[model samples]
Target: MSPVDSNALNELYKAHLAEQQRRTEHALQRGGFDALLIASGIEKFAFLDDRPYVFQPNPHFKLWVPLIRHPDSWLVIRPGHKPRLVYVQPEDYWHVPPEAPSGFWVDHFELIVVRKPEEALPYLQVPGTLAIVGEADAALGDIVPNNPPEVLNPLHYARAAKTGYELLRLREASALGATAHLASQRAFGEGRSESAIHNAYLDACGFAERDLPYGNIVALNEHAAVLHYQYQDQQAPAQSLSLLVDAGAHSCGYASDITRTTGNGDASFQALIDAMEAAQLRLVDRVRAGVDYRDIHLASHRETAGVLRQLGIVKMDEEAMLAQGVTSTFLPHGIGHLLGLQVHDIGGFMAGEDGGTIAKPDGHPYLRLTRVLQPGMVVTIEPGLYFIPMLLDKLRATPAAANVDWALVKHLSAFGGVRIEDDVACRETGAPENLTRDAFAALI
Candidate 1:
């Protein structure tokens, strides 16, 4: 991986902080509050065990600063005032404490450090109505998070558009994730087990499993048919026909979600993979300002139906196949979703800052995003074609069964599925930027 220039990053962070401050001030005024408090959430212990589960910082808090691993910290923001960060540096031998906050961002914030969580409460006392943003466990004394929708609605809606600093971080994350993907592809070609390929991905990215943005989907052969495939087998399949790796990496707090499918010397399956790539690229090209995301998803279904006809898997025309719900059987999930801060980011279904919703198209309940594309908004375009036994069996019982070629379906089921995903950024004009492709191209 290429080294990130710290000097450039620091400058970008300064601008990012300014934008965050401006947004917060507007949100506070809209919510009729004088102050807003965001907490770095506390860690929770496993049931009947002393070991704590992984600590996830609140997205609301991390948006202002890059303090991802630190918990029990707080950010106090008041309109027309410099934000205050109550850094908690507990003195304990049981675990290593967080180092004192020091970075380009630290200078912009009014820094306050204490030995315990409760010690910082006095400093948080500000005049007028103060709105807290965090889980109930993060509350201290009488102070608790109300999570006012009036304030959060606008903030969540605005987060869909990435800042310049956010775009840079997301690009770096894509490059890192692409590097890991290349390593995993090499491992798969060498006929390694699913667990081994997963390990290679982790090693190449230099991130522990717990540090990843989401659980890695390292599936082999028939396992690829399952979306969000979880477990990793220690032993390689007797005959490896295909491999589907849906995984990602993070830069700072931003995330990149990517997926790739590879076939092992299977000519027929390779053709299907090629076809899916073409269809996915077509969908990615449709991402730009003013385009509705739901149309892209519906287009993906049409493309998948076309692939089926081209492959002789279905004899019916595209229109008939779509009307009969044949395409839904092969492609069960949505084409893609908004990618950033969280893998499936918030506000995809929100109508506007005033708190309304844009309902999903009828019969497409799993679709994650329904808003129109806008400049600086990053999303994933993933179109898939799978042959799951359950779905196929259900289709067999329907009147549309006569249209499908069951023999061809059974043959292709050994290879499982094909999914090509890329993270794209909508632009002001012309074509949208393909971040995943650019990251992979850099590897050359």
Candidate 2:
């Protein structure tokens, strides 16, 4: 990874902070609140166990400052006033304490350091109606977070549009994820076990398993059929047919999600992978301001149907296949989703900033995003075609089964499936920026 230009980042951070303040002030006013309080969230212990699960800071808090590890912290924001951060740097012999707040963002906030979580209460006694934002667990005594929908709706809706600072971090995250992807691809080529390939990915990115934006899908062969493939086998398959790696990296608080598939000397399956790559790129090109995301998802179905037909798997025209629901059997998941602080970011289906929903297209229940594309929004264009036995078996009982070449399906099922994903950013004019592609291209 390249060293970040701190001077440039500092300037971006300033602008980003300004925008956040503007958004929060608007939300507070709209919700009839004098101030907004955001908690960094507290750690929780596992059921019947002393060990705590990895703490994930509130996205609301992260939007203001890039403090992901700190817990029991609070942010106070009121219109026309500078934001206040009640930072906690607990004194403990069992764990290393959090460092004092520093960096370009610190100066913008009124810093209030406290040794214990309760100590920060004195600073939070601001006048007027305060809307607290955070999980109920993070509430300090009677000051539980209300999490009013009126305030959150607009804020969540507005988060879809990325600030310049957020885009920079997202790009860096893509580069870091791409580096790990290259290493994992090599590990797969060398016939490494699933666990080993996952390790190579982490080693290349210098990220612990917990640091990842989400769990890595290090699937090999038939395992790829499972969309969110979770487990990693320690033993290498006797003969690896294919490997599908869906992994990502985080920069600051933003995340980059990318996926790639490789075939092991299978000429026919390799062709399918190539075809899917082409189809995915076409879908990526379709992303821009004003286009409905559901249309892109529907387009993906058409593309996947075309691949099945061209490859002799489905013996029917694309339209007939789609009408018979043949395409759904192969591509079960959505074409893509919004991407940012969360992997499947919030507000993908939101009607507007005031809060309503844009329903997913009929029969495409798995689609995650249904909003119209807009400039500054980032989304994933992931189109996949899989041959899962469960779905295929159901298809066999239907009349549409006659249109499918079962023989070809049997042969390709060994390779599991093919999915190519890239994170794309919508723009106001011209073409949308392919963040994943550009990051990988830079390596060459």
Candidate 3:
């Protein structure tokens, strides 16, 4: 569990509706689209649907987004063209909650619905030319990007920069995640197991009055040595174990990314943690705007190398350590990704703007953010070090390991892993300020 604020969800849709109106107007101003068909964000498929796991009772009952521009408030293309809104069913009035603002639509546009979502296309004022307000199906021919496409993805170019209201919701969500992490920290001990720690997260999320975004990673002992290790991955030896939690809490749609590691109170483990924390700081510093993301990733890699070499894990040569592929054994996943409406936010690369890349190559393929950072953008800066036997086996099979002193790597292998992740916001002065509370970092 990351974090959540029930109050945010109550009024979130109204703000989204307002943004939808702005997007519709902007899309119409761009060209010759007669009408834009809108769809509810809720759907049958399990994950994408915003509804809770238990709410799958009715397939069509999913009313995620308010479909019509407005029932009475419809838009007509110069009084002759047809209006917008293609929906799942064409009958009952949408039950607008009392909190929702009224009158966002003009009566000119027709508010029509249909049993089959695809059937509404034929009714479009200009069937072949309408820009979709939501994700379109692939069966609709060249009208879409490539081949046949049916449903249109209502594109919102404006949502990339978060509004003040959105930031508040996001911060509320992050706090909940912090709460979960603290509770998880308590659940991990020698006799306790990974499942126990994972359950602790769910309990904490419940206590904080929020929902869990995804399952938690409660790796204990040697199991914790492997990054991303959950119950399905592996488990601890019941003793001499540490824990790593890669979990977040989502409120409405905003998410807070955070990771915490456990130590078995061993002296060597503390030294490994010392190195990992220092490397994490170096990586966290890279969250500033205008900094090349690739540079940040590499700087983190090099920083890890500095600490590792002093601990005698590898030779001091940064390039040589990289060439040996020893670093990949510990940290396989990317440091972080954009956080917002989705667990992995979009606008990675905009349509018309040139999104340049500075972070590239060797073990960084999953680097989600490729462009320079910008103010108002939220990102997680998570850096970790883990040890997995399979990865160690692979490194041993390679010739590069000849240069790697395995005895040194082996010494720290049993120490489990250390990861420290924090949510940050890019400032106007090209620096990232921590969105998490000061006390949280103080514990580190």
**Per-model RMSD to reference:** 1.2, 1.0, 7.3
* Model 2: residue 190 alpha-carbon error in angstroms: 0.9
Question: For candidate 1, what is the TM-score?
Answer: 0.98
lDDT of 2 by residue, 263-297 (tens): 99788898899899999999999998999999999
lDDT of 1 by residue, 1-444 (tens): 466588877888888888888888899899899999999999899999999999899998889888788899899998888889999999989999998888667888899999999998998888999889999999988779999999999999999999989998899899999999999999999999999999999999999999999999999998999998989999999888899999999998999999999999777888899889999999999998999999999999999999999988999999999999999999999988998899999999999997799999899999999999999999999999999999999999999899888998898999889888999999999999999999999997
> How many pairs of residues collide in each model?
0, 0, 34
TM of each candidate vs. truth: 0.98, 0.98, 0.71
How far residue 109's Cα lies from its native spot in candidate 2, in Å, is 0.9
Q: On a 0 to 100 scale, what is the lDDT of residue 169 in model 2? A: 89
Which lDDT value does model 3 have at 40?
36
Question: Which of the numbered candidates is closest to the native, going by highest TM-score?
Answer: 2
Looking at model 1, which ten-residue stretch has the lowest summed lDDT?
A: 1-10
What TM-score does candidate 3 reach?
A: 0.71
lDDT (tens digit, per residue) of candidate 3 on 1-444? 233354554455446445445555455545445454333323333577745432111101112232212221111222234334443343446633223222323232355545543554465345445543333432232333221122112232344446555666577667778887888888775355566666677788763323455556666656666666647333435464566787888654466778877676777777887777777766776787777566777776777667667776655487777766567776777777666665566654433222223445566777776556777677778877766788878977876666566875666566566888877777778557676644265435
